[model samples]
Each structure stands twice: as structure tokens, then as C-alpha cells.
Target: MKFNFDQRIERRKTKSIKWSSEVLKNMFGEEDLLPLWVADMDFLSPPPVREAMMQEVEHGIFGYSIRSEGYYQSVAKWMEKRFDWKIQKDWIIFMPGVVSAVYYVLQGLLEPGDGVIIQEPVYYPFKSAILDTRCRVINNQLIEHDGRYEMDFEDLEEKAGDPRTKLLVLCSPHNPVGRVWSRDELNKVAQICTKNNVVILSDEIHHDLVYKPHRHHVLANLKEEYRENIITATAPSKTFNLAGMMSAHVICENSEMREKLRKVLDKNHIGMQTPLSMAAVEAAYREGEEWLEELLDYLQGNVHLIRETVKRDLPKAKFSPPQATYLAWIDFRDYGIDGKVLEEKMVKEGKIALDGGTWFGEGGDGFLRVNFACPRETVKEALERIAGVLNKEELK
Candidate 1:
């Protein structure tokens, strides 16, 4: 490998949320547990990203700054090269993060009583963004079959065609149950949204992290008409472990829709991107390609490790190999343990913290989302901890 992905760098005393004592207590309802719950990777950012940030810091002008021309060009070039999608400079709107952009879009595009549709067992924030903005949530739950997840197009079309439904929040290459939507799935979704007059907000934050043999379909790239109705929220934050920097790009092909979102951002007075973060975005997209490719290869190895370990040690465990993202959704239903009970056992007995299923939403029970973007040894240890807990062995 070209990168040192196995270096076990310490994050515990660095004000890390995943390693904080209070966070451990609050999240796992226990202390002194090894945390693997949070979605962030434990690996260092690509070398180019770190070097760019350091160079920016050396200049010593830490005042508020705006994204420059090269920043947009980098984004454009990335979209073209990675997704084969051409984006105009006017289509790009800068935001602090995808979550923030979601809130702003809801505020600007929908009214109090308008309904927003999202697939169930999705990122929990989609529900919060709607409710917090006084909009209604209409869930079109995905279908889980043979240990995999797929969208329910019939239910989606039924709900989206409703007069009150105005928007759809899509988690591309979805989070917990890692299924990257195929081209056919995306086309169906776009057609449904268009027929129902629903606007589409495709959260492609993890677009760059897809595994081999399966490709990520950019919904807007499927058709010209789809592009006009879709707003794509993408960032290097997820791909390069730069979420702390909090810089994301929202691509809206329609001028009016772009203006509406920009207006909300303007009203909130959010006009600054830290100099280091700005530089990091450019560097990650432009020079971090090789590192990213190597990272994906390492992640694929982690996936195989989990699959083999589960089958050998915990035969009842079932998981669908993820097509994208570093998160693994493992079904522990065959163990006959409730989600909360297993979570407690894992933390208290095994001393390892993992995300319990219920956090994602209904139908998530009996499942656990494991962040596998760590050293191979760490992955092995976490799984061993879980298997030992299942066998009634207490942590030593």
C-alpha cells in the first residue's frame, strides 16, 4: 500500500468526540469502553490535505475568507472526472456542511405544512431537518431482502405524488444499510419526483468512497431533466476525513432554485470558509486521488475481514457486503437479543462501543452499524470483543 493506513495514531486525548469520556458515557451508557461507534475514520487525512492546510496556516492570515476561483474549478473538475458530470460555475453554492445546507433548503423551499419524503433506516438527520423546520415527514421505507436493502419504488411513487409532498431527501449509497443505488433505481426515483412535482436533494456526501465492482450513480447525471430538478450536496469532508473542516458544495442546475438556497444562506449570514479548510478541499480533490484509491482498497480488505470473522466466530450474524462507504450493517437478530440489550452487553461486557441499530429509525433494531475505517488490527479486536461478549465472556 502507498499509505500508512495501519498506523494506530492516538485520538483519545485530542478533544476527540469519539474518545471523550462524557461522550462514551452518554452514547454507550458506559465508561472505559473502546469506541468504534462514530462514523468518522480513525485514519489520518491524505498527505496532500494535511500539507495544504499546513501551508495555509503558515501564511498566518486566519481572518474570514471566501472560496476562490480555483476552489470551484477543483470541484468542477472532480465532478467531471469522477462522475462524468459537467457542472457550471453558477451551479455551485458553498455551505458549511450538508446538514446545514439541508436546513437552509427546507427553510427556503418548503412551507410549514409541506411534506418531505425520506427512506427509512436512513441517516437520522433527514427527519430532524424536516421536523425542525416545521415540515412533515413522509417515510417510504426501503425493502430489506436477503440481507440487503433496496428502495420501494411503489411506496415512494405513492407518497411523493401526494399534493402535500414537496421534497425528497435521498441518502445516496445509503449509510447504515450500504446499498449504492443502481442507475435503474435512480431513474425510477427521478421519474417519480418529476411526476409528483417534488424537488430532489441527493446527498452524495459519500460519493467518492464507493467500493470496486459497483459504481455510484449520480441521480442528476442520469438525465438532463433530472439534473434540472435535483440539488446535489457533495463534499470532500467524508471522502478525505475532513468533516471537522466543514466545507461542502451544493450543486443546483436550476438558477431559481440555486438563488432560493443562496438567499437562505445569505439571511443566516454564513459567508466564511476557513483558509485551511478551503485549501484542504482543493488539495484533496486535486492531489489526493492516489491516497483515496489506496484507502478504498484497505477498506475493502476490512470488509472481507469482518465477513470471515463473523461467519467463523458468530455464525448467526448476517451482513450484506457494502457497495460503498466504510460502515458495516450487521444483523444480530439470530442471536435473539434486543438492540438495546446487545448494545449494553457489547459496551459493558466486551468494552467495545458500536452504533446500535435503533438510532437509524424503525426496522433498525437487531442490527448494528460498525465503522470499519480503521486499522485492520483495530477491526479484528472490535470483532473479537463483540464475539466474546456474545459468548458470555467479560472484558478482562
Candidate 2:
């Protein structure tokens, strides 16, 4: 209520990848497309983050920075207050972003020919990171029941048991699908990985954006043994809509594994955080909690709008209610349209740019991932465009 989340800030001329006209033309084949494909929100960063960065800018000195003790405390306090997971300063290491950290972990932990397991249809970067590192991706495809998604535990266990499989990438509160893994589900995953000697690299980037009724269980918080075997990659970037700041932290409890990962970063010459980024991350974790709560409320409203708009206008399209994150995974199979075809129509006919389901891999076919982190008005407009495209075809 105190913050104005409904204000529409124009990003057209901005260098934002999400709003760039050139990017729009390339991705959607239309220069006038309304973008909802990227995960970043259209809102301004939290006041605390903005103010902190401003203060940092006021100082003329722009120099390389090392993360301070205050930075670690902020993260530690955030983990303790929000997730009830107590993390020590020694357990944290800074990386520019989650995707970068994922690759670094793969390089450090696995051989070039080793296999890594990931659940799909999930974030594409998880697969790309594996492939780029010369590692094999063993997909234990997720099971879609009704509108919800669940892991195929048997397949995961078997894959983990394989000698070549050395790591498991867990997308906590998985993107696209938006199902926040429950404690029991996470326990099952950890147990299987632990039993098979597969280290877990849990990406909790969307951890802070979870819906109120559903809790986010930190994979490492489950048990000491599990914690020792896991590495968590998280940041304030996703939470504060500051992805461009490019700073994230890797939480590792195992000293040996931490040392190995750090060595990889050193060998690659990769441990510098921009002053602005450092200030933003520390301020976000320490003072942006209230802003985040309000943001979640606004996002929940947008989610309802999309779900209701689809039901009333399209009738056939279905969405699984998201438990975490502002991203909505919509199943368009009822329309009997192919993914690529639907994507084309959404842009050409609807003027809306959405992420096609097929881009996420097999089970993603006939689906769409909509980012609902914008204003309620924007979400309504995007959903209306989608509904118009689908409904018009039905009338014929």
C-alpha cells in the first residue's frame, strides 16, 4: 500500500534486453511487440537498493571491490529471518550470477565426460550450462499430473546411481512450472543424490518470491548431511528486479567442495563484484524485505488476473497456480495447437511476446511461460491478447 507498484514506467528507449526494440524484432519478428518473455520485472528496484546504489555513485572512486563482513552478515541475516536457515560467513562465496555459478560448479565438480541430471521442462540455462561444459545432461523428465508437476523419483534415483552422473541441479520453486518443492519432495531428492554420491547444486534464485500460503524449503536446511553435500546459488537480483547488477552468492557448507569450486573461479580469474552491484546486494538483503513483501502481494494479484482472464476468455487454456515466483506456466494443449504455431500466433495475431513452451524441452510442448511481475494492467493486456488469439480460432 505504501509503495506504488501500479505506476507504469516506460522502458522503450532503455537498453533493457526485455524492452529493446531490436531484441523484440529478433525474438518475436515484430518491433512493436509487448515483451513478457523475460523473467525480470518492469518495476523499479526497491528504494533501499536504489538509495544504496546512489550513495555508492556519489563517491567518485569506481574501483574493484571485495565483499566485506557486512555483506556476509546481510545474507546471513536474510537466510535466518526468511528461510530459518542459518548460514555462516565462511559458507558464502560471491559470483556474478546464478547461471555463471552453475557452470563454474559443473566445471569444478564434474569431468568433461561426466553426466549431470536436471528435471525438465525446466530452466533452459540448466541444460545449456551442462552442455557447454562438455558434460552430458541426463534429463529425468518431470511428471505432469493434472496441472501440477512432480519429479519422477525412480528415474532420478536410477540416473543418480549411474557412475557417470556426478551432479544434480535442483531448481527450487522451479521456474516455468512454478511448483515450490516441499520439504518431503526435497528430502527424497537429497536422499537419492546422497545415496549415489551426486552433489546437489540447488538454484534458489526465486526463493524469496514464493506465494504466502506455500513455504519454500531450502534444500540444504533439510539436514546436516544434505547440507554438506549441497551448494546453493541465490541472489537479490531476482528478488529486487536488479538482474543487470550481476551479483550472486554461492552457499557451500562442505569445506572441501567449497575449496574446489573456489579454485575453479581462481583458475578462470573470476571473482570481481562491481561496486554498485555489491552495494545493491547488501542493501537488498538487509533493507529490502518490506519492499519484497509488497511486491509479492502485487504479483499474487497479477497471477489471479491471468488465471481468471484465461478461464473467462479462452475457457480451454489452463494454468497451474504458482506456489513461488511471478512466472506462470500455462498449458495450451486444450486448444490443440502446436507450441511453435501458438507462439507465432501470439506475436503476429496477439502482439504479445511470450516464451514458447517447447523451448523448455519435451513436456513443455503446447505450453507458454508468462511473466506476471508487471503491473495488473500489463498482465491484463497480455492475457487479453492471448485469449483473443485462441478464442478467435475457436469461433471458426
Best candidate according to lDDT: 2
Local lDDT at 295 for model 2: 92
Off by over 4 Å in 1: 393-396
- lDDT for 275 in candidate 1 is 92
lDDT of 2 by residue, 119-148 (tens): 999899999999999999999999999998
Candidate 2 global TM-score: 0.98
| Number of backbone-clashing residue pairs for each candidate, in the order shown | 0, 0
Q: Give each prediction's root-mean-square deviation over alpha carbons.
A: 1.8, 0.9
For residues 1-396, could you state the per-residue lDDT of candidate 1 as single tens digits? Answer: 879999999988877788888889887778688778877899999998899989988898898787889988999999999999999998988889999889999998999989999898988889999999999999899899988788999899899989999999999989878889999999999999998899999999989989988899899899987788999998888899988888998998989998888888888887588898999999998898999999999999999999999999988889788999899999998888888888778888889888888888877898988899999999999999989987663223
Residue 97 alpha-carbon offset, candidate 1, angstroms: 0.9
Sliding window of 10 residues with minimal summed lDDT for model 1: 387-396
The candidate maximizing TM-score is 2
TM-scores for every candidate against the unseen true structure: 0.97, 0.98
